[model samples]
Target chain A: MAPKLPPHHSLQHSSTTATAGGQVHDDHDHHPQPRGIMRWLLTTNHKEIGSLYLIFSLIMFFIGGIFALVVRAELFQPGLNLINPEFFNQMTTMHGLIMVFAAVMPAFTGLANWMIPLQIGAPDMALPRLNNFSFWLLPVAFTLLLSTLLMPGGGPNFGWTFYAPLSTTYAPPSTTFFILSLHIAGVSSILGAINIVATILNMRAPGMRMMDMPLFVWTWLITAFLLIAVMPVLAGVITMMLMDINFGTSFFDAAGGGDPVLFQHLFWFFGHPEVYIMILPAFGIVSAIIPTFARKRLFGYASMVYATASIAVLSFLVWAHHMFVVGLPLAATLFFMYTTMLIAVPTGVKVFNWITTLFRGSITFEVPMLFALAFVVLFTIGGFSGLMLAIAPADFQYHDTYFVVAHFHYVLVPGAVFSIMAAVYYWLPKWTGHYPSEILGKWHFWLSVIGVNLTFFPMHFSGLAGMPRRIPDYALQFADFNLVSSLGAFLFGFSQLIFVWVIIKCVRGGVKAPAKAWDGAEDLEWSVPSPAPLHTFETPPDFKPVQH
Target chain B: MMNPVQRTVFRSVLVLIAMFAFAFALVPLYDVFCRITGVNGKVDERAQTLVSEEVDESRYVTVQFITRSGSGLPWILDVEQRQVRVHPGQPTEINFAFTNQSGSALSGRAVPSVSPSQASRYLRKVNCFCFDEQRLEAGERVEMPLVFQLTRDLPKDVNTVTMVYTLYPVAEEKAQLQAQVAPGSGGDA
Candidate 1:
């Protein structure tokens, strides 16, 4: 059992044997890929599978956006307008589900799939077939999730958190399907996470050390670990819901000797870490973009990595923060409050580091850079609101209010979603061999920033004024803010079309890109040709340690 | 087929299955938490040893008995007297009357819940009919006895303690008896 050669060495060994003058090297016998739909179905190529994940997530984003619009439209002017209250509930529920699970999470995973291999100078993921399987499972899961709308009693209206009793005894018949679909999605997430961990650990270029890897990869490494640790817990809770609904079990029935709050304990045990899961990758994306645009090596790269790991660890201890209003003991509430606030230290570290990276550097506001900047300012605002929500007493007022809505949207839209847009703008030239139109890109960026702020900022005023969330109609006092929010939502939603146009134009060919597309870009990825070769790094690039 | 990566993937899949089972495990885990905290006011199933020497004679607590028939069971249940005044640590007994109003014989169970759950742990039971199921023939009427004592350690602020007994038909068990009872044969008078 001689040790097998490294993949690159083996490729070189096999190809050198097949040709006399090295003019005709054929390694396709080992790495043969078929054409057309079967390529996506049967191919183990990371880039192709990455494309699949990105495309799928983009479609889900629109679907979720539409659901949010429906919610916004109904809340536009107080009285129920376009949709019935029941459908509005469904819209909010589905919007949350699709956005969190189907859109933002998958989008981050897609970026990981596309960039991790290139950045690490590896040929492909550690287990490419498993990667493909994970990618394929998402569509199946979401399709099943969407089909539940046609269920006899309608889709899940128990809110995205799906607390028991409401989700079990009183839920529509489609609740079972919702649980099963979530289970499928959970399985997909766990599989994808495992693949990511394996790839990062096992497939880095020969000379690269753990500290030497990009911040994006570091954040993902922690995020992947969080996924592995928590997604299973999510599966566990949802399965309990399934049993309570189908079996004669009393897991959540007080009448049958079960406690409803227990369901919340189990769900938040998974749910809290899940919120970090959504945001940590955004941290990574912003970390990557800020340094590049600022023309500096990232300020305190080691601290960034430590902060990400700390946030992940702290995430587990603070899940009950979401349950403060549900009657936790004073000691328990204070403990959760302290732990939740402690998260601010590392988060503040990350924000401080980004600003320091930007200070006194030759900064330029390209589309990606602009989005990254907005992410910094707006995500911090979300963080402050989160800190307020962490104070158990203050949260009594903030919980389940439109203020809570405003807080998370600030983090998610400007925070996570903005970083995603930035990642696209930063990476598009690399993926497509052409640059997106600068004029159109800036238009998309400005509209998105304004639209996002307009949509979510007013909700804070409405929330502070005591308007509750999830209601289709609000009191007359809330009418003005709701109007502003709806108008902003429409503006934000419509402005995204310009982004689509930019991407399509780029992919169809515009300005040809050089090997290093961005002036200040640093990494193994930029060392490769634009529109990276289909099968890159047959021989892994020699590692050159980056200088600070 | 069993490459190292495949083996790792397989192990992750096993962890998933184990976690799925663990979710179900939380049901019993939650019950244990409740029991330890006495949070839900679920009385212990068996008799608790009484602290004989700590009886409080000066304080009189009002003990109220409340009974109601659960949804499907046609058992008429009520406490003969709604309330009793007793000293802490002194044993007390109350009679609850139950009648099977259904046309056929049926089995039933009564579950007890204590209000002001903070003091639930201090309400010790000496002997009670709630410990077992009671089966009765059609039109059967019987008086059941409940025996309990409040510990002297019960919070001073809790002056009144209400114990509610909700009687539920052991309907599924009754259905099981049907196969043994042979539906058309001598089940009814």
Candidate 2:
């Protein structure tokens, strides 16, 4: 599939100058490349920018992990042994904020940056400069957010949701900074989403139709739309917060003719879609991995795509499920409950497609496949709990409890985070020209699986047993679950160090991979050389659509 | 001439801005939705001049009044009558006594909500103290009247309506009064 390259080793420079018709002319390296730190700071190359995003998210993952560990340590034996209630609140808040905005979202974006162009046979992201700009904004945004911890009032003590009145009238002086940081992050996400949309819509190879594109690209295209639709709602909600906090507006303050419940409405409107934004890409990644390892065409490719689009649509309708305990009217409660339950149908379809794909095919449990299988089982568990919570009456029992914690953590940790680890293992051969160490990868995978389940599964029982979430202390009856959860958290947290070591080892040296890293991998990405030349498909590869 | 890539980005940015506006739009939209559906237990702040004369005498609804002082408001509030039984269209009057317990002058505004929130629309206030802020001198006490009538068309299943009035401190009024008292000192508090 390799089109003969030009004799000179030319960098695949996407034309900075946009000519008419949106045709990106490939330009060879003309100017001398800057060296060292400047190369990363000034580069607009998609691969470098992708690496930057991944690295940044990795760093944030550890930071957020440490915060989680802090909370877990405090909950180890129950009686607020390590931290005060205020600082505990900060830890939980910061942990959530960092994981959602800084870690998971960026990791997906990073993967999109690295894989989308390769899969679609594009020279680079359509908006390369914008890609550079978006990646850089995260550091500034998170730095401003982290710096709030040092401010006089000592960071956001309100939960990550930053619900009103607590975040406004009673919030510390540092909340304004948290708002600003979130604004910056929202802008970054908007720009990044726009870039992905532009790239996916405009940069596919000459013969590659929308349906012909890989699942990752398709999922990201939808995810980008979700981001564009909802990130601004987040911006708007936070801006309203800014007004309420500083401008004497009562957007959320009851004294000023504003209802605090309005805050929940606006928040969940943005937030529910944000949840999908994190997971849809995981679906895309797993869809690719399952078919590859199972050695069979995905059983229901069309159904999978339709199910994904339907899930995105249903996400908008179900935001109120999160607010069931806040006294929503019965009709509204029914509307949200029915809509929320409706979401399970599409989600179930995707899960069924995955299982059917594996039903009779030759399957090997490569590290990526192992994680993908775990994702399928555990994410379904999460989905079932979500369905339980969707029943408004049942939600009243589960709301603000460890059950809610267990549900989301099940989906996010095993579901989304595991997919990322899977993707890293799946693509490391392509990115680094070497296979990741199988023995170490298995250890990392097993420990993570055990640690994550141990950490979250007990929360289900404890939550059902009536242990509320976000508290620094627990009753003596809840002590055993807390201890086990805390130990599991530490184990899961440390296992990640092994993941980092695997990545570093793979990048430096291992069994060298060929152009097609995995035998069953059939995407346009496999057409490129391993350690994929800094410039791939500079001259567009003639894409041959494989009949599934 | 804008390229397709540039156009997609431009349109996406528009969508982003539109969604931001939509978020703010939700505030008024939510209010309108609540007003139409009576979802959030919000009682209409405007006084209703028209009171239904056709009384539903056969059906009686219990009207309960509950008063709460919000945090930071140094005031005690009491109702002269805790509960009243009235025909749906009959006007019912209740007296609320407010006492400023703080040493300094203080001002507060009352916010009202009705339980069985769907019934909020049917319970109309002919006149209420919640329509304006009340100010009191140190240790001063005042009684305010609330006259309301549940419209004859109140939901059949609803036999009782609870009106909860929570008084919140009005900071702006206190600041203005302080500025009037001391011209030299900043009234920024």
Candidate 3:
């Protein structure tokens, strides 16, 4: 078969050779490019597609954030305040679905699309058209998902987990649409994961060995595998749900000779690995940032890789821990509890490795470094709470409570989301050809940290004080913590506007950046010109494996 | 004709499809697993014949009966005995009455669960009302018998086993089929 190349491949080659002096130039101008929005709608270029993914996710983050504010606002005084209980459930559900599916997961995929090929010295993703198809599927999926709110019965109110009986028998009329939307999203994820796997495995530069690849690439490769492994399971479970709802099957309906507990099992089986899929790439991003900011070779690079792999493996085993309150047998409970606790060891190794990398090193706290540091501390806090929740006996008390909400939000907002922010700040110079304003960047970071903490920290107290989650109102005893959390949520929600402003400001104009933006950075992506040309590595760059 | 990149994509896609199949496979796998370990408290569907064996008089086990009506099922279930103390290996009989309050005919099925689920396998039932649909006409009432025995080797730590039977309304079409096949068969005894 003839080698698949973009229509502008020859023009891209000419432009690369034409710019030997390494000055930043628009390669798209040299080539006959599609005009207007058509460029984005039909572009096969990885970098453009990457930008599309990022822009799309940023918009979704705000949308999901607004939904969360609705939920928080209602809980501000805790007495059917801003919205009714039914609408409140919809807000919470939509917030979780949008953030996890649209915002966090896609942001990671966007970063992967942009950086993986460049980091690995490849021209573009192995299947560029498939990449475009995958990214486009997300909007269609979410639009259908959001449109369900207007479909008479409201959108999915069964929580993101959408347990059976509640999600099937008792669900609203719009649930069929919810199932269809989730199916589309699952397909997009599987396709995206396939492209990532194929690109990493087959498109690495001639000399770039598997172990020699950046931690981001390694983590994403594993994450892609996880996605490929579990996304279909999600598809299967939802398909069963569809059958139960419309076709009169009993995959999860207890009334139809099916077990409700089975739904929890199947959902968590996919969900547990899904948790790692979001965070493993975050690990990759933090690993990349810490070494650059610390100006040190990453401590225990091999262990870091092994720890990630072990965490992915352990993720599948520990899923039953989520079902601890569902009256699992003692043996199954003990088994899950022990496996869940065992996950902490590998996670702890990663934390210690990051700290050790920072130890006595000539370290500079750039905006990215600040976020990375917070990720290390706060993610560890999330991990500790996870360990607490892993104890079966303890989980019975903490399950379906605000503490569970707090634990995950701490990990997701500070852990995964923080890592994404750090990555963007670290790489905005490369993508925009301008140094982001340090003052503005720092302002965004501090406000975000405070807002995030204020929003989630009090949840721990309220949950322990007997406050249940997914409730629109709580008793007066839990009033103060809810007040603090609501205020914090709003504070955190609005501070993100500054993040968008930073990106726009940096993109429009800032201090012009050199080819190597960070003094301590060492990666193949750094070798490319800033505001990376529309096409990069058209001719493969010789890669020298770093001596650890 | 496929290159290595295409091959990798092909394999990943295969993994995706295989995992989908694996998910569906889990349904039967879960059933088999539950049956083997009794982790889900699902007892055997097949009835067992009464086996003549010595009753373990040294041990007394408490068997508690709880009946719940599922949503949309306008039926009242009354268990003659709430709790029974019986010797291991001794056969026990319990009577349960079902009354349909609805104005029309309704068909319902009872789903049973044995709590402290590990004890599910040790509790053998020679006869059960859960084996078939319980169809009743307007204001009709029916009484049924549940004949069961606890095995002689009941675990010493398991002193109490709770059996919960939840009754669910069956669809009208299936209820009509049952009426045509077995008319007035499971009525008051």
Candidate 4:
């Protein structure tokens, strides 16, 4: 028979009571954790795997950042000084591939792994073993990718887009290795996404209805679905690339009756949704952070969810916007241009909702809140530039220019990367059982803000002045901006060390945190103990839907 | 029996596999889509009825021909006539001359693009060299014929259509595949 529960604990664990054999037991026969390195190697625990992913992404961040600095250092002046154009291309390409695939994406996944189960009052991810596999595959994929640098012709120099012929016939001998590595990474993403979707849909606490789940959980659910839908498409495109390169197939070879433009079609079909895959999770993170720091319930929660869904759906239609200057027909260009512009409506709804969430609320400028606000402002700037690029005729001028570079960096750095930083600061106390040093976090945030702007802002002017991207050197006319941008890059690159230091310091020891780390934060995650126990919600917590 | 969690995971895996198949399906799907819409300048291959069904003599469209060779293809390509004016539905003939600049026998394929791409939807090719591969001996020069007609219903604003034929070097294996498919074939009709 189930033991009678006290009213307070009863409300939270109602679902536990609903289960027929829900009585708590010591369960002394639990599997013992292994010793040392093997502990992390073989653990199926979500938190442990989450830590591994977070650590891996951090390492990838610095590596990809170093590559960026190499590009910046080379472009510091008008003439080639630091490296040859060949190495420069490799740096830019690797920098993009690593930062997108390894850094920003895995960082989001790490947060999801850590927070989803806690927020939903579940014991762990639905498929914990799959979670471990996903985290492990990342390092393998990235290792193969970085190893290409040592190959005879260096790594993939043909831009991260890897437009065909350049990636096919004219590709380096190491291109095969690149394709293989991408396959591994794609498998990891697809498996990870499956785990997330299953966990979210099937593993929620009893009585925790769909709408009752936190925005972070909701956003990740959508993001996971998007991942499942599109990562396969990425796999498909890369597979075709492999067949075209190794086999005598003409999938992209025009002489073989294959159209090079077809590759772009397939790529952007996956690529456009890919942009949202990176950002939707950021939306979830910011929504959670803003509400907590504002000391109020999130404004327009339903609209926020709708907006994210609309953005995901609209993402598919606007892919051809990326090909505007690729010589699409007038009707296609117009259709894609209009569809791309329509995305701004839903995106605007999200932005307006964030500001309204803050309006007239008792707001605190915590580290997470600061980053979230910066994201709102800077991501909007990127959105405006995106709108400008959406005009098919105007795109002819901005395509392949630093303007495009600046646009994406604004969205990524402040938009996605900043949100990840905000999430880390927001949840570090819960994870570590100690509050991080606020002063150091602020310094990190300010420096990052300055560094990001300094580095990317000037690219706009240079690009508008007809400076193309992926070049090691440029005309003397663009020298001043390049110098300033490089200086900013170095400053931003080094400033991240403070973030690492802050996390380490916090983990070591600091001000003790209560179960509710933040006074205004409301979620199932906050209901758990600080330094969440090794096994959480083993008997699923009772769900009492929070009242707004 | 699988638990609810197991069922959901199994279903998700199925969806993922289906999507992977869908991605490959997109290749043929895109081809069919382009053929139907005539977007992306994909020329429709279905032979049109030769009855000269609807001829609009009142409208004359100026079609400009542009010919070029892809880099390192070792071929010089030119159109017999740079431009021609033809009444709607009236079959027009143009010739593209190709000279193999390379010393060895080479195989080449021509891809046709109709621009202002909007006009491609109404630009019907009765017969063109783009449908087949052309193989030439060293220093061989061949003139290929393209017979086409402009549909009467082509949007009134599109008074001019530029057709560009880009000659690309064919892979040896692809050339062999082409030979296998159609043996002893020269330039088509």
Top lDDT prediction, candidate number: 3
Residue-level lDDT tens digits of model 1 in A108-171: 9999999998888777788777788998889999999999888898899988999889999899
Model 4: per-residue Cα lDDT over B1-189, one tens digit each: 877677877887888889889988888888888777777777765555444657887788899998877644667787888999987888888888888765556788887878876788888787888778788786799988888988788899988999888887677634553444353433321
lDDT of 2 by residue, A505-528 (tens): 998999999878886788988878
Q: What DockQ does each prediction reach against the true complex?
A: 0.32, 0.57, 0.65, 0.45
Indicate whether candidate 1 or candidate 4 has the larger lDDT: 4
Pick the DockQ winner: 3
Ranking by lDDT: 3, 2, 4, 1
What lDDT tens digits, residue by residue, belong to model 4 across residues A39-115? 78877777878888898999999999999999999988889897988999999999999998999889999999999
Better candidate by lDDT, 2 or 3: 3
Cα lDDT tens digits for candidate 2, B1-189: 777887887898888888888998989999999888888898788998757488888999999988887755767888998999999989888899888776668788888999989889888888899888898887789999998989988989999999999988786774564454353422222
True contacts kept of 2: 0.84
Question: Where does candidate 1 chain A have its weakest 10-residue lDDT segment?
Answer: A13-22
Q: Please name the candidate that would achieve the greatest TM-score relative to the true structure.
A: 3
Candidate 2 regions with alpha-carbon error over 4 angstroms: A1-30, B49-60, B71-76, B100-107, B135-140, B169-174, B177-189
| TM-scores for chain B, listed for all candidates | 0.83, 0.88, 0.89, 0.83
Question: By the TM-score metric, which is better: model 1 or model 4?
Answer: 4
Comparing candidate 2 with candidate 3, which one achieves the higher TM-score?
A: 3
